[model samples]
Each structure stands twice: as C-alpha cells, then as structure tokens.
Target: MLDFTFTEEQEMIRESVREFAQKKIAPIALEMEKTRQIPEDIIKGMADLGLIAPTVSPEYGGQGFDAVTAGIIAEELARADVTGSIPVFYLVQASWGHIFDKYGTEEAKREVLPNVTKGKWFLGIATTESDAGSDVAGTRTTIRKEGDHYVVNGEKMYISGVREAYTRGGGHITIAKQNPELGTRGMTLFYLPLQSKGIIPTYVDDLGREGISTGGFTIDNVVIPKHYIIGEENRGFYIVHEGYEYARGLISVICAGAGLQSLERGKKYLKERKAFGQPLAKFEALQFRLAEHYTKLSFLRLGAYWALWTYDQEAKGKATRFEVSKAIAMAKMFASEWSNAAIDEVMQWQGAFGYTRECPDQAAWRAIRSFAWAEGSKEIMRVIVSRELLGKEYISYK
Candidate 1:
C-alpha cells in the first residue's frame, strides 16, 4: 500500500510558505544578487514566521518540523527565489540546526540554537577543506585537547556563510582529526565560532547565489570549550553524515521546485510567443521537450519527497540509516542534472534572451550547477547506491 499525499497540516504549511515566498521572497529575489546579501527584513520576517531553523525543537524557538515538512518549506522557497540564496540560507540552518538540537550539549545548545532560530546568528557546516570535499578521511584540520579546552588549527575552503557567521554572530559545526593514527575514527566534531580569536575570514566570488557568501576561514589555534563538542569524541564522521543527508534531501526537492517553476515560466512564454506560423506551444519538438521535462521533474519531486519520508521513518525506527543514506543518495543523484537540463531547455526555447543575466532561468541554471558537488557529488551518490547494493567488498576506494 502507498499514499502519495501531504497531510492536511503539511498542506496548510506548504500553502502558507508558498504565500510568504511569493509575496516577500519572490519580489526581492533577484535584488539579493545586486545587494550581495539577503535583506535584514526578510531574515527577520522568516524568524518571526518560524521559518529559520524550523527543524529545531520549540524549546529552542523553532517549530520542531520534521524532515518532510522542512523539504516543503525548501521547495516553496526554491520556487520563489530564482537566485537560490534564500533556499541555501534556510536549508543550511535547518539541516545543521537539526544536528545541533540532537547532539549539541545542553550548555552549547542553550547558547547557540536560540540565536540561530531567532535569525540573530548563522549555523553552518564546515567539513570541506582545500584537500578534502567529499573525502572526510582526508581532513587536515587538527583538534587537540588542551587542559579543559581544545585548540584547532586548519583552514577550510569553499564553505558557505563565512561572512554571515563571522559578521552576524554564529559559527559552524566543524570537523578535525584528534587522533590521526585511527584514520576516520580519529575525527571529532565541535563548534568553531568565526568570531573567535585567531580566525581569519576569506571570501570568494561565486558564479551564482551571490546573496549568500561562499568563503572559508583559517583556524589558527582557535580554542573551544568542552561544551562545544558535538556528540562524543571521535564519532564526528558519523554524526556529520546525518546533517549531510538532511541537506541532500532538501536539495533534491529544491531542484524539483526550481525546475518545475522554470517550466511554468516556459509554458507562459510558449503560449503567447510566436514561432513560425503559430505559438511555440504548437511546435512538436518543443512540446515533446516540455512534456518530457514536466514528467521527469514531477517524478523527481515525488522521489525527493519519498526520500525525505524515508528519513522521517528512520527517526520513528521504521527504517535503517543505510536505507536512508541510499534513498537520499538516489534522490539527489539525478536531481541537479535533470533540473539543470530542464532549465537549459527552457532557456533554449527563449533563444538569446535565455543566456543573459536578466533571465531568471540563467541564474537558476548557474545555481543548480553547484549542487552537482555541494552536499555530495553526483559521482559519490552513485558510489553510495553501489556500495549499498554490492556490499563493502565491492567498494573501489576502500
């Protein structure tokens, strides 16, 4: 038996978020690119609406929404914001905040989650380094306990929200090797505030999603208290995967929403725009593309939601972690490629105008391109699915 419908409560949430996104985020979505920042009003409004880190428990000022509900918010935001900035802003916080709420010590959660949910601080994940993006075992960052505290020394590159957390007042759940001899088991996870001493921030100009910063920080002996440690020592590699899985799930839905919305815009243009003797809609080639894209994107949307539902089921002890991982990987595997291909076809239908900066689909195309490697690379997704199906003995990189 299978049911493919959102709950009444979930439908209400989707409607509410769609309205907010259309009214507030849509109008100013492109403007965020010019400004190079999401407006303070929008951030505050999201906080007021409990849309910022809504996955955190209500005790910490969040709505305590599950993964599927979080994906709904993500989809609506993606539909509205062509720049993809607002969705990243929301998803990062929502995903990482879930991890923090679950594993952060009482002292640290009390000190950080409230400000994050209130939009007063940014919470981000910082696992990628210059030498390591998907290879968690290759992390060069080192964390060694010093008395009652720990000191970190490493530089993270290609990270998001470096400016926001550094300037606004928050930090990232960072990973480092505490015992190199133990391989991946040596890693530890802890909060490293960008505002801490000896931290130097650097910025990079990205191709899209300019509203949110993509940069890195140099951790030169940044000291953190024991309370900042997330979960147990030497188990960060496992805990951080939970956050990555959450983000990959959100990204899948976001790709579907953005691509579907682009199709809607294409539909309008096809109906009114002239091509040859009639409207572009009458062209068999374009019609086939539109139909195929619509159908594929619709299935992508369903697969993404089903992946998220699997994530929620895992929480209820109905599914396993490996199942969730494989499901999320499969959902994210084709998400960006299919979405980008659809957006590209839509842009092609618009001719030269599609390649220009004014074309929202161009921005979307650029933004979605990053997801091929963001949470996890598409190649890595295949590796995960293959690993699950073929077992550990068949793993190539092992």
Candidate 2:
C-alpha cells in the first residue's frame, strides 16, 4: 500500500512555498506574457527560497531536497502561476540539475551548479531535434572527440529555455550521437553553453507559457571540454531517461495543481453568478461538473505524489528503475487530458468572460495543453506503461 501521508517538515515546506507563490508569483503571473520574461525579482526570490533547483546538493548552493519535496514545490508553483512559466522554470532546473549533480564531474559541478541554483544561470535538457521529439533514437546530432575536447554539430528544435540560457550565461545538457554504428548505445550527453561560438538560436511563438521562450538552437561545431560529459560516454541514452522521468513526475503534479486552481475559480463564479433564477451553483448540471472535476483533480494529485515517492524509493534501493518509470508513466498518462478537461469545463461555465485572455483559466488551459507532449507525449506515456506491464519482449519497437 502507498503511504500518502506527508511528513510535518514536508507540510511546512508546502505552506511556505504556497504563501510565497500566492503572494509573489500569482500577482505577476499574467504580466509575464507582456514582459516576454520572468521578472528579475521573482527569479531572485525563488533562488533565495532555494526553489530554483532545490534538489541539488547544499555544497553546490541547493537545499538537497528529495523528489517528494521537489514535487511539493512544483505543485505550489503551478497553482500560483496560471501562465505556468514559473513552474516550468523550477521543474527544468530541479530535474536536470539532479542529473548533472549526480553524473557531472567535480570540476563541472563546481563551475556550473552554483550559478544555476542561484538563478544566475539557466540549465535545461536538449535532446529533441527537428526529426526527433519522443523518438530519442531518431536524433541526428553528432558529437565527436577532437584532441583534448569534443565537438558537437546539429540542430535542436522545440526546446525550452533557449532565450534564458543564451542571455543568462548558462546552457543545456544536450545529447548527440558519439558512435552511429552502436545505435542508441552510441549516444552521448554533454553540456553545451548557448553563447559559444558557432551556436545559433531560433525562436517560435507558443500558444501559452509565454514568459519562458520555447525555441531551438543549432550547435555548429560547438566545442566542450572533457568534464562537460554527463555520466559515461555511450550511456547517455539510459541516463537521459532518468531526468525525463523526474520531469514527468513533476509534470503530473503540475497538471493536477493547475486544474484544481482553475476549478477554484469556477467554483467562485458558480456561487456568485446568477442563472435563470438563482445562482449557478444551485443547478444540478453545472454543480455535477464541478464535483466531477474536483474529484479527478484530487485523485490526480494523489497519483502524482505517489509517482514522486516511488522515484525517491529508487534512491533508497526499495524500488527498481522500471518501477519508477511505470509509476511515472501511469501518473502522467491521463494527467494533462483530465486537467485540460476540467479547465475547459471551468471556462465553459463562465460563459463569455472565460473565452478571453482576461480570464486566468484561459491561460491555465493553454499552458496545460503542452503537458500532453512536453516531457514525453501522452501516447508515449501509454506505451511506457504497457511496455512495463507486458514485459520488454512485447514492446512493439523492440
């Protein structure tokens, strides 16, 4: 049986983050779309609270939070930021930073992680290419050894944090083919600084999450030193999945939080707005939707936290990697669909006011639409769950 009870310390962390997010992030949440960036003060405040990449070690300027603690922070940030920008910023760092901390060399960790945790630099993952999104094996980027360093050459599209990393003096943990003949085993992962010579950035407009840039970068023979490699060469394929699992776990929680927040807005509208005779809350139809949405979101919140707990258990040797992967995939499979359904229904209840950008739920709905494919596609999540349940021998691609 799953232990759903949170520790007192965890509850305290939740309360602190909830207060900070409601006060600081909620007010400026929509303003980010117009500014085209997160305010510097907001970033600094999150850094001061150790929220940027709290999963990293204290020695590297992070709080060394566990997976569940990180999920709590993600949930609170999602609830506060209807635009969903701040939560993305926090989760990318928390997920990938954990990987870099665990696998990066001492020199690299000392040089990079401190700035990332302090919000002085942005760290993200970049494995997707024009040809590859969820299909990691289709990635065409190439990394080759040259003397004392390595050279990477390829184009990556639909990546997050492109603008931040380029302007903020940081970069992404990128993946490339080090040996083509070995297939997935040939893949290698390394940090590629965005401002390096020969690197070019491209931008695209997203339907939501406007505060953070969603674009791509072309790595044209970008040179990196030996220490930048994450884990061992040729093991990047296996290693990157760990980071993706961490992110998916957080995304499930974020979906639940955003949905519940939208429902709250809907609830307020139902109680205050008059229908044909009385308040909308008195109607069985609208009230039934409200109850159904609340129930699904509540269960989603529970499932998301359960996945995070399973992730933490892997660290303690109480669970296997496959267990963590299955738990995360199952949690995420219906997360975005269910959340978006709830948000869409919430919008429907508000009549014309909900259709415009003036409505916060509109932003929440747009922001959540991406979660179906962000870390991994919803279809891919179903595949992961089925792969584990039916055994690897039954995997279609295999």
Candidate 3:
C-alpha cells in the first residue's frame, strides 16, 4: 500500500510557508540581487516562523520538522523567491543544522544550534576545496590535535555563507585530513568559526544567488576546542555525505517549485498576450511545450518528495543509506536540467522581455542553473545512481 498523501501537519506547514513566502519573500526576492544581501527583515521573518534550521530539535529553538516538512518549506520558498536566495539560505541551514544536531557535542550544540535556529547565526557545510568538489578523499586541509585544541590549515573554495557566517557570527562544519596516510579514513569534521583570528576570507562573483555570498577562506592554523568536532575523528567522510544528501533533496524540490512557478507565469502570459491576432495559448506548438514541461515538472515534484520520504525512512531504519543515496541522486540529477529547460522555454514564450532582470523567469533560470553543481554535480548524481545499479565492484572512481 503506497500512500502519496502528506500528513495533516505537513499540509499545515506547506500552507503556512507558502503564505509567508508569498507575502514576505516574493516582494524582496528580486531586490536581493541588486542589494547583494538578504534583507534583515526577511531573515527575521524566517526566524519568526521557525523556517531557518527547522530540523534541529525544539530544545535548540527549532521546530524539529522531518525531511518532507523541510522540503515543503523549501518548495514554497523556491516558488516565491525568484532569485532563489532565500531557498539557498533556508536549505543550507536546515540541512547542516540537522547534521550538527545529530553528531555535534552537547556543549557545541548548546552553544551553536539555538543561535542558528533563531537566524542569529548561519550554519553551513564546508567540505569542498579548490582541488576537491565531490571527491572527499582529495581534501588537502589538515587538522591536528594540540592538547585541548585542534589546529587547522588549508583553504576551502566556493563555500556558501562564508560572508554571512563571518560577519554575522556562525561557522561552517568543516572537514580536514588528520592522518593523510590513511586517506578518507583519516579525515575529521568540526565546526570552524569564520571569526577565528587566523581565518582569512575571500569573495567570488557568482552567476546567480548573489544575495548569499559564495567564496573561499584560508584556514591558517586556526585553533578550535575539542568540543567543536562533529562526530568522531576520521569519520567526517561519512557524516558529510549525510548533509549533502539532505541538501540535494531540498534542491530537487526547489527546482520543481521554481520551474512550476515559471510555467504558471508563462501560462498567464500566453492567455493575455496576443500572438498572430490571437492569444499565444491557442498556438499548438507552444501549448505542446507547456504541457510537456508541466508534466515533467509535476513528476520532478513527486520524485523530490519521494526522495525526502526515503530519507525519513532511512532515519527509522526502514531503508538503507545506499537506497537513500540512489533515490536522492535520481531526484536531483535531472532537477536543474529539467527546471532550467522549462524556465528557458518560459523565457522563450515571453520573447525578449524574458532576458531582462525584471523578468522573474530569467532570475529563476540563473538560480536553478547553479544547482546542477551546487550540493552535488549532475555528473556525480549519475555516478551515484550507476554505482548503486552496477555495485561497488564496478565503481568508476575505484
């Protein structure tokens, strides 16, 4: 018996998030691109609604929502935020906060989770480096134990929330190799405050989602206490994947929501705008495209929710990690491509107006494009699925 219905609580969460996104996030979403910063009011609004890091336990100032519920909030934010800034902001915190809550020390959790869930601090994952994106084994950063502290060295590139965390007071859950001779087995995960004395931050101009900063930082022998370490030493390689999977699931939903919203705008335009002395809606070619895009996006939405549901099942020991990985990879692999194609067509439907900054779909197209490589590249998603289908013995990386 397969059930597709959302629970009563889930529906309420979706409706509430949708209302808030439409009323608050939508109006300022585009403005964020120009400002290059999310408005303080928007962050405050998300905090008030418990939309920031809602997955952490209520004891840590979070709503303790499940994965599906988090996906629902992400979908609404995506639909409303044309620039995709708010969705990025929400999903990163929600995903990494869950990881921190699950594996962080009680001392660290008590100090950090409450501030993050309250939106006073940003929580981010920082496993990617200039030399390594999907290959955790290639990490060059090192962390060595020094009495009561661990000193870190090396640089991380293309990390999200660097500026926010550095400026506003939070940090990334970072990974560093503690015993390079043991490869991935030697890695450790820990919280590294951006405000630490020896840390140096740098910025990058990204193609989209400009409101949230995307940049790198050099960790120059920054010392962190033992309490900041997440999970066990040499176990970061596994724990980091959990955060990535959570983020990938949210991204899948965000793509579906943004694409569907774009199609809705296109539908309205087709009905109102005259083309060849009739509405564009009457054109069979455009109508066919509209139908195809809508149908595909609908399935994408379903797949996204299904993936998130599988994640929940894994938490309850009803599904395996490999099952969750394959499902999530399948959900996210086509998410950016299909959504970008749909938005591109919507832009085509609008002719030249769609290319301008004022057009919402243009912003959406740019925003969704980044997801193809954000949490995990589409290429990596394909690899995960293939590895699952072909078994580890046939893994290409090996």
Candidate lDDT (C-alpha), each: 0.95, 0.95, 0.95
| Model 3 C-alpha lDDT per residue in residues 44-139, reported as the tens digit of each score | 989998999999999999988889999999999999998998899999999999999999999999999999988899998899999999888899
Cα RMSD for candidates in order: 0.6, 0.8, 0.7
Q: Candidate 2 has what TM-score?
A: 0.99
Model 1 C-alpha lDDT per residue in residues 1-398, reported as the tens digit of each score: 88888899999999999999999999888888899999999999899889999999999888999999999999999999999999999999999999999999999999999999999999999999999999988999999999999999999999999999999999999999999999889899999998999899999999999899999999998999999999999999999999999999999999999999999999999999997779999999999999999999999999999999999999999999999999999999999999999999999999999988888999999888988999889999999999999998999997
> Which order, best to worst by lDDT?
1, 3, 2
Model 3 poorest ten-residue lDDT run: 24-33
Better of 1 and 2 by lDDT: 1
Clashes of 2: 0
lDDT, candidate 2, at 11? 97
